[model samples]
Target: MANISQLSEEERNDIVQRLKRIEGQARGVQKMVDEDRECGDILTQLASIRAAVNSLNGELLEAYLLRCIQNPDDFGSPEKAVQQAVRALVRS
Candidate 1:
C-alpha cells in the first residue's frame, strides 16, 4: 500500500472553491423559495445541488481511501478501515 499523503495547497484550494460554489447554489435555492418560483424549477435546482454534494462526497472518499486507508502507517488496520468507509458510504 502507498504511504499516506497530505493534500497539497492547490488541492485544498480547489476543494474550498468547489464547496463555495455549492454554497452559492444553496443560497440560490433559498432565493427561489422566497421568490415563489415554480415547484418544478425549485425541485430541479435542488436535484442539481444534491448531485453536486454527492460528487463532492465521492471526491472526499477517494482521497480518504488513497491517502489514509491505503497507508499502513496511517491506518493500523486497513481491513477495518475499509469496513468503516463502506459503512459510512452506505449510510450516506
Candidate 2:
C-alpha cells in the first residue's frame, strides 16, 4: 500500500480539532449511558458520531488521493495507487 503524504499544518490542526470534538461526543455518550438516558437518545448520538467519523475518513481519503496517489512524482504508478485506495475505501 502507498503511504499517505504528510498533511499540511492547517489540515492537521483542523483534523485534530474534529477528532477532539468526536472524543467529547464519545464521552457525552458514556455519561448519558451512566445516567440511564433513553436508548433512543444514546443511539442518535452514536449515529452522529459515526457520521462524523465517516466525514473525516472522506476528507482524509480525498487528501491522500490528491497529495499521494495523484502525483506522478510522488508515486510511480498513480493510477494503480488510486485504484488500490478506492478499493480499500470501498471495503471499509
Candidate 3:
C-alpha cells in the first residue's frame, strides 16, 4: 500500500483487472470441483493460480520497493523494509 499513491489510474485499473481474472479462475476451479473434475486437471488449475498470485506479488513488490527507495523517509527504517520484503518473497 505504500507505493500505491504513486500509481496512475491506469496502473491501478490494470491490477484490479488482473485480480478479477484471478477471481474468475478461482471460481472456475470451484465449479470444476463441483463437477468432479479430474485430479490432474484440478491440480493444473491450482498451479496456474499459484503462478498468477506469484506474478502479482512480484509486481506489487517492485512497486513498493521503488516507492520506498524514492521516498525513504516515508518508509521508516531501512532494516524494517528489507525484512518485510524478504519475508514476503520467502512466504509460501
- Which candidate leads in lDDT? 2
Q: Encode model 3's per-residue lDDT on 3-58: one tens digit a residue.
A: 56578898899899989999999999999999999999999999999899989878
Arrange candidates, best lDDT first.
2, 3, 1
- In candidate 1, position 80 carries an lDDT of 65
2 or 3, which is superior by lDDT? 2
**Top candidate when judged by TM-score against the true structure:** 3
Task: List candidate 2 segments past 4 Å from native.
Answer: 1-5
The Cα error of candidate 3 at residue 86, in Å, is 4.8
Model 1: per-residue lDDT, tens digit, 1-92? 32223777787788889899999999999999999999999999999999999988788778766654556355557776676667657766
Ranked candidates, highest TM-score first: 3, 2, 1
- List model 2 lDDT by residue over 1-92, tens digit each: 44433777888889989999999999999999999999999999999999999999889877766665556455557676667667767866
Compared with the true structure, model 3 gives a TM-score of 0.82
CA shift at 26, candidate 1, in angstroms? 0.6
At residue 26, candidate 3 shows an lDDT of 97
In TM-score terms, candidate 2 sits at 0.81
Cα lDDT of candidate 3 equals 0.80
Candidate 2 residue-pair clash tally: 0
